[model samples]
Target: MNRIALAVCALALIVAACAGSREEVVEEFLPSLESTTTTAANGDLPSTTTTRPAEDQQIDELIAGLADQVREIRGLPLALPPLEFVPGDQLEERYQALNGLKSIGSTRINEAYLQALGVLPEGDSAADLVSFCSLPGFFDPESATLVLREGLADLTPYGRRLLFDELAGAATNEAHDWWGTMASLERSGNTEAAVGLWALVQGDAAFHAEQYVAESLDSTDQFAIRLEEIACQQESTSPP
Candidate 1:
């Protein structure tokens, strides 16, 4: 499948939080990365809370919003891969092909997204990674597994700041370190979650309201390239 389809599957599976087999060490240490701070704890942090109800439709929209942000960074137009719409004769085969996916319900997906993306109901001392982002809780065993397997828990506290806080400044190298980690998430030829994670790496401050990174990259490819290089030191590390 093409990268865009890979990305959609990644996002769908991301609700259950799986990456690839390769293990990597976080290359740099930013102090305070381990501290679990809430937006309530720091008024300066962008509020993860939204006025919208923390329900499925709202949360799905929010998750989609983040996913769109990553695709913009990678210069991907919003489109699913061709294979997603299997022929009628092949439908059951495709369903069985996708059966290995973990059975995380939509409500759980919404809750994890709300917590990971919005920093809600905050009181836990330790955090669990539900996607490329982290949430504080032992609420689900699968989520805990995802945290350790993805090394989401192991990333710098600055990572938590970047993924959840919405506007923390990370050096160009720091950002790419994140980019590399995200790229590692694709498996079963799926890369959707990595796309969303890329957006989390690029801070919200980089965009104006209603603007997208794709449009910006179209105008200045070098600028985006420089940002990735500064962040990860790799040449041409495009997001899925």
Candidate 2:
């Protein structure tokens, strides 16, 4: 499916949360939309419009508002990159595709070295550890794009907070050249310094995100968002 279709599907799924059952949710969400397809000028992926034009515009506005809030809270000037939404199920595929472009041998060597140093567990590769430990959404510094997990359709409280987290991250990157610094540290094999820097960067973003929540959202929404975040964290770390 094309990107627009995937976005519509993602949004639809989010709306479907109030509805019952997975199969029913998909059926309810897809049947209401109209779709049209056209090939891109570059002859790459075909572009499709699967939802109302206003839906896309709303998403753009939502991002802009969140970005402004992030800048306000973090006190950083931000030039936000283009935004892309991928279906939640395609997250792993998208991650692997991006990860594949890196130097595999160097990455493996680093993973082995880190594991030997007890930075990573014996069986865990760097890629696997990152995929598991990091948040679902990320700002890709190389591509200068903010890629978010799709299900942000209705701008539910949780969805809004999650989007804010990514915006905060993007702002942090803009201010600090986060990825470039991390890459330099990695190349120099300064593992301890790299880890410390990574922690500080993430903590900065998290702090701003929390500030946004506390300052902007209503008390009810603030509580709900925090509860959902904690639940998600527990779910991610839980044993299958």
Candidate 3:
């Protein structure tokens, strides 16, 4: 197999392994989901509201900074789209809504073919696995929007890395019209080529994101993120 095919195979196995341990991974890097108590603005009554943590509220400013970094790293002028943060419960809904524009039957056929080749586990749809293993945010090329999962304001190393990745994706889209290219490839019935292109695009974003992390984050954060990546790789290679 070529490099892209090898990368896709590796990613498929890693995602399969990760499906069983997602909660553990999340708990290790993300804060607990307990609601915070806040006092009323008037200072007379203490109303219990599940407000976003103060630290998490800086997500917008952080994303703005990330966009600038992406531009610098990619050396491309980027027009960032409007950003939206959706609750965890709505993640799949949003994903499916965006996915609706694509050919679901084609996805299913591809999933089955991969499973037949042992690239993907039986009984696991590509769509489901992708949704499960994807980062907490994505850039919607069709809508020209950056959508993130709420509560990323804590700015954990993992969260920061995700921001960089998504920003890079946005930059890539701006420069190359990612969705349009993929759509054209699909329309031409070049399924294998389309898959290869998808992998290339994602890999490019990931490479730039890592560069951003190395250039911008503190040593401690960089080390923590690297350790997390190593752990996930180890898990993927471990025996079942």
Candidate 4:
């Protein structure tokens, strides 16, 4: 009888230990296992923002300046050190530091990455610019001058005229400029290279022009016609 009772007691102890183990697991993991949801800005997935104390902001500026010096010494382009190099938890702070160094411009940021990615076309350029790319987001082959043209209402007449002159002379520096070079190459019957550049410019312009139309009440189809003209030129000149 004692042997049987001892066996029952061992079984009871095993059941008790299992119950305690389950209880411990519940206590340890239940809080973290609660469901979580994220708040999105427009259609984009939630992004984290890092806020900087005033002193840290100054330090970041200094570090960025030092980084610029190092880049210049190596004969690299004058732009911000990549994000991985920046010291910050806040994405905005890092972006700002990078922006201060590169000055790559808002148009490249807004119309290039976010809108092109279709996440937030209306995203602020100053907010989202990056340095370099494992996959490059966008390339604005148009110079600052060409961007000033097309009577798009955002640029001055003098600017537009200046860009037109640059566009005309682009054939000479065709090596450095894509759109201008492509157009020139097309004139010279280098249809393949022209097609490549045309694809890029047309893709970017199609997105931006559509964005501009959607955002503004302005009925100006000026940009649309320009895009259409470029597309038609590409199709006509492309060698099938």
Q: Pick the candidate with the highest lDDT.
A: 3
lDDT of 4 at 154: 34
Give the alpha-carbon lDDT of every model: 0.28, 0.52, 0.55, 0.29
Q: Report the candidate with higher TM-score, 1 versus 3.
A: 3
lDDT value for model 3: 0.55
Backbone clashes in candidate 1 total 13
Candidate 4 has its poorest 10 consecutive residues by lDDT at: 131-140
lDDT of 2 at 197: 45
Error in Å for residue 82 of model 1: 40
TM-score of 3: 0.64
The C-alpha stretches of model 4 lying farther than 4 A from their native spots are 1-177, 180-190, 218-240
Model 2, CA-based lDDT: 0.52
TM per prediction: 0.18, 0.60, 0.64, 0.19
The regions of model 3 sitting more than 4 angstroms off are 1-57, 96-109, 127-134, 227-240
The order of the candidates by TM-score, greatest first, is 3, 2, 4, 1
Against the true structure, candidate 2 reaches a TM-score of 0.60
Tens-digit per-residue lDDT, 163-212, candidate 3 = 67766766666666666766665687755444444545566677777788
TM-score, model 1 to reference: 0.18
Which run of 10 residues does model 2 get worst, by summed lDDT? 34-43
Residue 23 displacement in candidate 4 (angstroms):
60
* Runs of candidate 2 exceeding 4 Å displacement: 1-55, 93-136, 237-240
Q: Could you tell me how far off, in angstroms, the CA of residue 105 lies in candidate 1 after the best superposition?
A: 26
Residue range 1-240, candidate 2, lDDT tens digits: 111222232233233323334334334322321121211121112122233354456666666777777666666666666766677656655554443313443321244544544545787654443322224455666767766666544565666766677666666666556667656766886543443344444445655666787899999998887676566556555787
